[model samples]
Target chain A: MNQKLFFTTNILILTTIAFVSIISDIGAKNYTYKQVNASDPWARATSKLAKTGAVYIKNIHNKGKNAVKITGFSANIAKKVQLHNTVVKNEVAKMQHIEFLEIGPNKSVQFNPGGLHIMLMGLKRPLEKNSHFPLIIKFEKLGNLEIMVDIKNIGWSQKKPSNYKHVHH
Target chain B: MKKIIYSILIILVFSALSFGVFFISDHYAQKWQSNKLFKAKLYDVNGKTWSIKSLKDKLGIIYFGYTFCPDACPTALNNLTIALEKIDSKKLQFEPIFISVDPNRDKPKIIKDYLSSFDTIILGLTGTDRDLKSFTFNIGATYSLSREDPEDENYLVNHTVGFFMITSKGASLPIPYRNNPEDLARAIEQIKSIQMSNSKFKKISSIF
Candidate 1:
């Protein structure tokens, strides 16, 4: 009888974990996570001297019928990760922290450099090229979705200045 | 009554025309004022006094930003480095100068450490309040820093995006910041050609 109870309790916990409705950092102790369908999610490689970094995602679409709110984000690499949007007025750039980001159904949001970005503060160490770190994106109703952000080479989004004729020594 | 109303309407139209003229002239004045900033004294992080005048015949690119800026500054610097590298012609002498508007937190040592992330050699400069004001005002670059308290270490600074490409004659062309490295490289070449023609014209005039 005890064995049966134990088996049922383990099944319930598994079900809860599988749903992934629990909060980040406490629930879903396992490393297994569902992938967030995002496009070109990457962070720029940083020098060792840098204490802050920025992350970019080309597009994040809300497939659900209802609107979803990205309440917060957590990263293991940085001390803090905040949603930030840069507004340029009369050539002046101002970065503002967003309390939360909402995505309407069938709509997409872009996180790009010099615009919407994920600002990583108090970086524990420099982010290297081709490396990746796990980022937990918390949603109000969708729960926590974990995504791996790859660190691309600096200026990867930009084109080469010109075809190298080797004039620049 | 008719005469008085006509005079008032005439006066209103004259005042409106003058206001429009002033606005147009003021905008052009700021663009032309960069030549005067060529003489502005810039104190580099190395405790060296430098000026656009000292750069002489080279194209000088000036960017005003703080070391603590996270998104725009780094991306601008990276893109600039690429553009410079692509335009690496021995005939086209160019120098990239980064001016720190937030000198309170961005000391010489801090600025040095921050600039090391890029591949190119950039001269990091900061100045006293008076000196900075003269240069920034003449160039029309604006910046503001907000702090919770005077002792607040983590503060955000809002600054103008883009770098001013100063030609050999001190005439500046403002290039807005974006992901277009090709545009930057092309602009640099265009400036070089214009400078070349100006020099050629100068030499011919001297012969006369």
Candidate 2:
């Protein structure tokens, strides 16, 4: 083989290897979750006809190095935005706040009742039953995702928080 | 045969007297529970009115504190939650309501946000001073504001540390739970037993 042709072939092989490795990494760094409707997201599970006052964002698994960024919460229904969790100690019910939702590579995040859920504080109007609300959830790497959450009936007795284990009484 | 009949009569009289004494004591105890309650109206985060009356037919566990309270409020609330855990769920139906004595600092949104940290069912109530004083006095709960520090806007509030477990009909549920896990568990067991007895009586009456 000519000397010039040999050098060119070596450079071509290196470039191809680099390209394959990049593509493989991108494939391994994706996260997926089961999409959830706003109705019966967290608090709704306590009763069948719970008011879907809050939007449900479920199956929030992320496979990346950075934490997931959830923004663009402004909407007509809720006046304020917050993250909420229910923690039990000495048999008392306590509500907590979380500032960030951490998502690691090949790791997932959950926003279910009694654990971690977005609190849609200060509802501008009553959450009508069987209605749907559009929520825009943004991820740092994924950019933006849109989900529609359905409203369920309010005051259903059977639905409880996800972490609530029924007592004998 | 005459002597035997006289003895039987005496025994019957003694039984009746004992029953009367028992009934009177029980009635007095129940009345005491009702008289021990304090009055206060609670407001939700949205400034909606929340009264203890609405939770009738259920047990009410109420605590008075502010969101800006440094330590006592959170610690007491946590302790109450722990006590609830020691209770048998079947025996008691209760709700924990948090009333902010400091309405100026603890707004509806602030109370709601701060209360989100616990794992229990807590309702934050805040209202006008007159309303708070009357409610506190009626419920037998005492609260006062501490001096504010210029360094921080969050001030401290000194208040009572206890919960009232009331029945669905606005009567006392007779909760003798203490801070200890074992004692709390025992008290809860007794409460459940009492509820069960009452329910059994109801069922028997219905059948008759």
Candidate 3:
């Protein structure tokens, strides 16, 4: 009877250890949003004639100890997503596509109108005012984080609408 | 023979004086000419003829952008709108205009609807493809359509991103695109100051 008890105790110990290690392993590989955060995510409402959309996030900060890289992005409303930085030289403005963006530890990157932004092409539908949608931000080291983006009223580009209610995801 | 030579000399002197006068006048012609922004042919949102010249006796503000632009156009226009709003009631009235470079996609109605979304009454205008090109080029602005085919609808337009201010007398004050409203408002004030100085100079030079 004592041998049977000892065998059972050993099996339980081994199983517990295995389960704990599996969880820790998964956590290390996929920290998800715990490593980074996107704040003040918003987009302007698109007109019916608009074929593309743009998403602006106030800042993306790497909250973790290590740097994080953003590899890809997608929106529920767009068939394709690209990172674009609008550059102005000698009064001429153009948008340049960016493939990856890295955020160092304790550092943040900003996205705004007329600057760096996520461009959504082949929009499935026009983004309406006061509407919110989901966008998946893929990380190089960490996993993807789905962020909710609020759409502002048309032409509310310079000032955040006074009635804007930020819905945190 | 002496009489003939004297007559020839007098005639030559008069001709030279007239030629010098004509050359001086030709050299200063363009300096007093009107702004190209005021002379360019464009159709307004109502399909009626429009130009910066119509804003006579008032300040003229114009910007080159497409209504379909997702990011830059709205931001710049908004900055313009806010800056215009900051101008005091005592200040002379101004007409703010938006010229669409995307003639293929941006129609009069589309531009009208787009301008309605903004706070102020921004006059939206467009023209034929060739006309648009020449208008922008002559006005010292540059723009290009991304796709070879504008019917693609998904194309983008890269344009000179900023607002141009003109005094009532047609002196141009071009301000580059900046996201700050304060900077824009300050530029607007500069335009007025420039106009003030311009009229003051004109009054003093009128005696000449």
Candidate 4:
């Protein structure tokens, strides 16, 4: 009886150890999964007369193995969407369409004003402030992920120039 | 000695003639540009015909862009608005005008709505391609539509982003103000100087 009791206690301790290790492994995996997540997806409110608007997304990839490539994107807010980069040449601004954007391992890509942005053309309706819309981002490795873009005020992402001051009389 | 003297005399005469021609041509070219700007007709957001004369007595910061522009147009317009607000418009009459390059999409109503988002004082203008061409040519502005299907609504327009300062007399000032608050302030100072010179000229003419 004494031997049986000792055997039973050893089994219980081993089981507890195995369970704890498994739990920790799962936690680590989840952390890795979240390392390459998208954050701060936002769009600017558009006026009724505006036919196009831009969407910005911050893509972060923390993994050191595979580089994440954003292949395409889609949204119900517009008839068509494309990736575009604003190029300022000779102080003249022009938009250049790009095929795909790649975020290398342990790197991040920011889609912001005066830089890479998702151009939504032929907007079905004006994007109002405080509203949200669905955007599906397709990736080369991770497949597709649906994100909700928060619509903010027009020029929300614009940083006021340091010397800029509004003088109102 | 006689031959050398003749050659020297001929050279001097040619030099004087070239200088005279250059001076006259430069003067007339400047006059023509200003006259063309005054005569060029454009349609305001109200669909009413307006000319550069309509903007007289006010310093105008004119820019040409499309409504669909995402970054540059808004940045430029916003900077202009901020600059305008910083100055005392009552003392120095300053007007901001946004001319649309995409006239097909930017109707008078559309442009009016777009400008309202920036500032109420801003005047939005749109016109046919021909009208725009003449006005832009006179003002030394350039814009081109991207190559896309005629029916495609996703086209882009490449345009010059420099703000053309139009003096009160409907002439494009030679000073180039890239869309910034500091440059705009500088432009304002230059405008004031021009105004002073004009007033002095008027006073002299009155004396005459």
**Models ranked on DockQ:** 1, 3, 4, 2
| lDDT tens digits by residue: candidate 2, A52-148 | 1344444455555555555445455566656555444443334454565555555445454334555565455544555666555655555555555
Top lDDT prediction, candidate number? 3
Clashes of 4: 0
Q: How well is candidate 3 docked (DockQ)?
A: 0.38
Clashing pairs in 1: none
The TM-score values for the models, in the order shown, are: 0.72, 0.41, 0.75, 0.74
| Model 3 alpha-carbon miss at residue A94, Å | 1.1
Candidate 3 lDDT, B1-208, residue by residue in tens = 9999999999999998887676566434534444454566789988998766677788777899987676778878878878887884343577888999988878888898778777788888899878787767755788987786846766778899878776645566676566777798887777678767867765654443
Top candidate (TM-score): 3
Give DockQ per model, in order.
Answer: 0.40, 0.02, 0.38, 0.36
Q: Clash number for every model?
A: 0, 49, 0, 0
lDDT at B176, model 3: 54
lDDT of 1 at A139: 82
lDDT of 1 by residue, B55-103 (tens): 7877788888887777888877877888888888343588988999988
Worst 10 residues of 1 chain B by lDDT: B199-208
For candidate 2, the per-residue lDDT at B134 reads 74
Which structure is stronger by lDDT: 3 or 4?
3
Error of 2 at B129 (Å): 6.0
lDDT of 2 by residue, B60-132 (tens): 6667777643233544565566666656344346677788888887777777766665556677788888878
Off by over 4 Å in 1: A1-36, A158-169, B1-40, B89-91, B167-169, B190-208
lDDT by residue (B1-208, candidate 4, tens digit) is 9999999999999998897676667556766777876666678888898777776577677889988886668767776776676775453577788999889788888888887776437788877898788778888788889857988767799887777777655556544645566677677667667866865654444432
Worst 10 residues of 2 chain B by lDDT: B31-40
